[model samples]
Target: MRKEVPLLITILTAFIVILAFFLTPLAQTQQILLRWYAIIGGFAMFVGVWNLLKKHVFQVSRGKNTFYSLVLVLGFFMTFAFGIYSIVKYKDAFYINSPFMFNFNYVLAPLQSTMFSLLAFFMASAAFRAFRIRRLEAALLLFAASIVMLGRVPAGYALWHKLPLIAEWIMKIPSMAVQRGIGIGITLGAVGMSLRIILGIERPYLR
Candidate 1:
């Protein structure tokens, strides 16, 4: 009965939202339900934090990857403490940008940039291997990529006047068409999946 009730509510809510889009009479109801959704989502965030705290604390206590677990736990608690301190100091519940923001900007931002820089090098190495002229498709892709890269720079215009135009044509025609086709496919797939969930044929939420 518990499972059945949740499934029924899910289906009913899905239909109500969909109908509200097309029927003006249910618009207010949809807005109220959306507020309920936001409230539930806010509560879910605390549940997630609780779970993360438990996992990290357990790891630290058991001495399994103790250093990493301790670091993670300290980072989490420090951030939380700073956030609370900021709110109280400013007397604004939603106010951001304090010691916490400084830590994020100075400490985390550079680390993230470094990680992304390393990722770019790895991606370039991968592209070099894949772009080798081993097959017809690979050859064409390499040619197109080279043109786009070169044409976006000043050197391509100095080297060849027509290179930029060709790059633009390739991007605007072939690239745009492929993107549109992929977007349509994704939209159709999402619609099918949503319908399955709304009909209660797919119960992924139960798992």
Candidate 2:
């Protein structure tokens, strides 16, 4: 009964959302449903956090990589504590230079930037291997990538007068067209997936 109820709600909600596009009354109902969805989503985030904490706490209790697990748990609590303090101390309008903001700027931002900076080396290595002129397409891709990379720098202008102009043309024309084409393809794929879900062919929610 529990599973069936959720499946029924999923199917019903999907149909209503679809109908909302064509029906005025349903559209108004859809707006209300959207607000409810937002509320549910906000609550779900807390549930997710609880689950994460429980999993990490279990790992620590089991003495499996206790240090890492403990760090994770501690980080989560510290962040949460700072967040609550910021909100309370500022009355929902946290100051830009608050303790929480400082932690985010000095700690979180650097960690995220450092992670991406480390990936740059791996990306360059991969690109070097992939950009090898093993075929016509590979050669073209390599040429385009090199031009784009050089165009982004002042050194490229110093090296050659027309290189940056050629790079700009390639980016505004071929790159933009390819990006738009991929976007359209993704939109079509999403629509098809939605239709399949509405028609019950894809019962992921039921699972």
Candidate topping lDDT: 1
Tens digit per residue, CA lDDT, model 1, 1-207: 878999999999999999999999999999999999999999999999999889989998998999988999999988888777877887643455677677778888998999988988898999999897599999999999999988889999998989899889989999999999999999999999999999889999885
* C-alpha RMSD of each candidate structure in angstroms: 2.3, 2.7
TM-score each candidate.
0.88, 0.82
| Pairs clashing within candidate 2 | none
Error of 2 at 138 (Å): 2.1
Clashing residue pairs found in predicted model 1: none
| Poorest 10 consecutive residues by lDDT, candidate 1 | 91-100
Best by TM-score: 1
